[model samples]
Target chain A: MRIVAALLRRDLAQMFGSGQRGATLLPVLFFIAVAMLYPFAVGPNPELLARTGGGVIWVAALLAAILPLDRLLARDIERGYFDQLYLRGIAEEVVVAVRLLAHWLSFGPPLMLATLPAAALLGLDSETLRTVELGLLAGTPGLAAIGLIIAALTIGMRGGAALAGLLLIPLAVPLLVFGAGALATGGSGGIALTAAISLLLVAITPFAGGAAIRAAREG
Target chain B: MEPARITATDLACRRGDRLLFRGLSFDLNGGEALQIVGPNGTGKSSLLRILAGLLQPFAGKVERNGEVALLDERLPLDSDLPLGQAFAFWNRIDGAGYRAEELRPLGLERLADVPVRYLSTGQRKRAAVLQSNARRAGVWLLDEPLNGLDVEAAAQFQARVGGYIADGGIAVIASHQPFDVQGLTKLHLGDYAP
Candidate 1:
């Protein structure tokens, strides 16, 4: 437990540390940027904006999560942090799990907060805003999970970050379907299912990421 | 820490289609220092990884009874952080602190405020050595541990490994250059090449 605490502390510090400040905010700004641009791209039709704005917000959140993958596993793996942790009796899964939490903490809450202005930007009503926020709360974890899995898998490959973003879209489609679909359905069932998928992804990511780390060591 | 033992039986390593080494075995006990000497691309590093349990052997098994620490080509320190902060990061995880005297021997105290990326090759190597020492693991797997050390730091590193082994820790070094340490066993990896 002490080891995990130390791991969590290290992971959190690394995720939000000084040098990564720009990268950390890149995702948030990217979310808002996407929100801001949607209006310009489709022209100023308030009805069309409000109708599709919730789904647009969901899309922005997913893309923002991908922004951090460039440094995620590759930096640590390249720096030999995972090897040292493994030697210290800290399993790769623990590192991946803690990283998942840190990634969510750094990316999720802020993106959720950004949605406030994003909702207003797209002129979403209070009810639609609430649904978007709740759906994001349930969906972003799944996004973070898939992001991490792809990050681990793509480690050491040339042009991996770009490839990971492409890889993530297909995998994240389900989360998008369930979470963003909730906004359209106006039902709690969609939110519940999104959370379920989020839970499943979270559970599987540790094992999958752990194996990827070990395999990456060999490659 | 409890006494440590690292043993491998008929261990084989293959990188891609080509086999690196095979039919190798050894027993490393506490207070033992084994130096693996070989030409480049001969899998000296791979053997160390196999022993460290970082890589799976192509056709063998290894039994380990204690914690391991590795100091390879990579420093493992956060490059953007100052030297002190980088070491502090590992110290937090290792649950041990680097004493002032320990830093002096490695000549790291004076460079504490320098970002690791700014340090020269030799300085980064020394900081990596210092951090691995901080791990205080029972077994040490060092790949080319003396790669970039200057004359002074090289001698100091030799002395430190001396102390590490004297304290019942096991040290395995993989380097083409001779390591200056007492009672060192030279394991030439070329003998085991397939």
Candidate 2:
């Protein structure tokens, strides 16, 4: 429990300490505002707005997730923190899990918060708004987990952004599917599937990210 | 009782398709210090990581006594943390703890609240060494422990390291700089090839 706290604190400190919080927050706000405005530019048609809201939210979240991957392991790799992590006798899985959780706390919550205003702007029904929030809570962890893996894989690459996005978007397909599906259906079954997928992502992310980090450190 | 330590037998390593070293064998006993000296690009850091169990040798085995602490050259500090907070982070990992007030007099306390990224190279190196010592392990593998230290800091480092040895701890330091490291056996890695 202490270790987990320590990890969480470290992640939060990194995000705020380095002023990365502002960078992350700005994009989310911009994305939400821009997405909301799309309906205004076209028309205030409820059917069109409702049909597009889920995909826009998911896409915005995906873009936000990608924005931070370049910063994740890159700095640590350059400063030799990754090697320090390995030598500290902490299991790689624990380290990866802690980092992923921190990413979610920093990047995931603000995304959900921003989604609320966008949902309202798009004139989403209460049911649709609830679905959007629930789907986000359920699916963001998987996005973070996969983002972390790609970050580790491309720690030292020259053109990391293009590569990380290419590698991660494919893996995030299931997350996008389940998340958008839940928001679109506005039913308990959709919520259940989203929850299961989120749980699976939370469970499996550590192993995948841990293995990648270990391998990268070894080289 | 003293814990059994590792014996490296015919250890070999390669970096980027080139062999760094090969046919190397040695034993690290408790309370012993070995200095690995070599020219640039000779893989001294690589050798230290292998000993610390972070890197596996291409063709050798390293049997560890128990837990090992490695002070990597890159001093992995949390740039977002105040210096003190970064030091405190060591506690999260097993075998990493320290007497907070005792370290205050070392001038580290003044900079405790400063983020690690703002520290000078020598200061960062000092913190890295101190943090590694905090781990309280039987064996410490330090890669270029004295790289950026000034004369006074070097003396302080030697004293601390000597005290660690007196307490039955072991250290292996890799450096190109000379220091008065008494009773430290030299392992000239330049003589070996990958």
Candidate 3:
């Protein structure tokens, strides 16, 4: 338990603490920027913007999650943190789980918060904004989980960054479909299904991510 | 705190399609030190990893008793954080009380505020040694432990390894450079190459 806490603390510090990667706060900025760009790309059609804004937010959030993938676990594996931790008898499953949590904490809430300005940018009505925020709250955990699993699987390979990003979009389709679908239908059911998919991903990420790491170690 | 033993029998390691080393075997109990010596690519590092249980040996089995600590090329400390802060992370995981007496001897007291990435090679190597010593494991597996050390640091490392084995610990080192540990037992990895 103490090891878990230590691992979690270090992970949180690394993801959100300071220095180049942490201080960039890139995901949230990218989220807001993506939101900001779509309106201009489609011209100031408030009606059209409002209609597509929620889906745009979901796509933006998904893409933003991808931005942090390269730094997520590759460098740590390359640096031999995993082997050291394995010596300490901390399970990779636990480490990956904590990492998933840390990854979400690093960007999930910030992306949701950034959405407020984004919602305003796209002229989303208050009700739609509420739905979009809730959708993100439920969906980002799944996004972070997928990002971590892919990060672990792609570490050390040539052009891994490209493969990781490409891998994420397809794996994240469930979250995207249900999360953005909630906006289209404006239904609680969509949100619940999104939450359900998020739970499944959360449950499996530790094992899947752990196995990928162990496999990477062997190869 | 107890007698520690790590034994490997007929270990074979294959990287990709080629076999690196085959039919390698060794045993180390408490108070013994084994140094793996070979030229580059003869699998000194792989043997260390195999002993440390970080790699899957293509063949053979290993049995270990007591905790293991490995100090390889990688410095587990966070590179972006100040040295004090980085060590603090490990200290916390290690149940917080780092023996200041052990650390001061390494001559790193003045580097507490430096970011780990900014540390020179010798400094990083010294930090790895300090961290491993802090672990107080029964078995220690080190790869290229002397690569970046200055003469003084190398002497300090010899002292540390000597003290560890004197305290009934086990040390397995993989390096081509001559390591001057007391009662050293050497394994030339090339002997097992296929």
Reference A-B contact fraction recovered by candidate 2? 0.68
- Candidate 3 error regions (>4 Å): A21-24
Q: Write model 1 residue lDDT over A1-219, tens digit each, in one string.
A: 777777777778887889676778889999999999999999989999999999999988988888998887898898888988888778999999999999899899999999999999999999999999999999999999999999999989999989999999999999999899998889999999999999999999999999998988888
- What 10-residue stretch in candidate 1 chain A is worst by lDDT? A2-11
Better TM-score candidate (1, 2): 1
- Model 1: residue B33 alpha-carbon error in angstroms: 1.9
What stretches of model 1 exceed 4 Å from their correct place?
A: none
Model 2 stretches astray by more than 4 angstroms: A16-21, A183-186, B1-4, B92-97
Ranking 2 against 3 by lDDT, winner: 3
lDDT of 3 by residue, A121-157 (tens): 9999999999999999999999989989899889889
Task: Write down the worst ten-residue block by lDDT for model 1 chain B.
Answer: B93-102
Model 2: per-residue Cα lDDT over B54-141, one tens digit each: 7778998888786677876676677767877777766665435545665653557678778888999888887777776576778877
Candidate scoring better on TM-score of 2 and 3: 3
Instruction: Give the CA lDDT, 0 to 100, for residue B53 in model 3.
Output: 86
| Residue pairs whose backbone atoms clash in candidate 2 | B21-B194, B22-B193, B22-B194, B84-B112
DockQ winner: 3
Tens digit per residue, CA lDDT, model 1, B79-155: 88888877777777877757667688888889888999999999989888877758678899999888889888888
Using Cα atoms with residue i matched to residue i, what is each candidate's TM-score against the true structure? 0.96, 0.91, 0.97
**B1-194 in candidate 3: lDDT tens per residue?**
68999999999999989899999888888999998888899888888888888898999988999999988888888898988888887887776435566568887788888999999999998888877658688999888899999888898888988998999999999888899988899998889999
Q: Fraction of the real A/B interface contacts present in each candidate?
A: 0.76, 0.68, 0.76
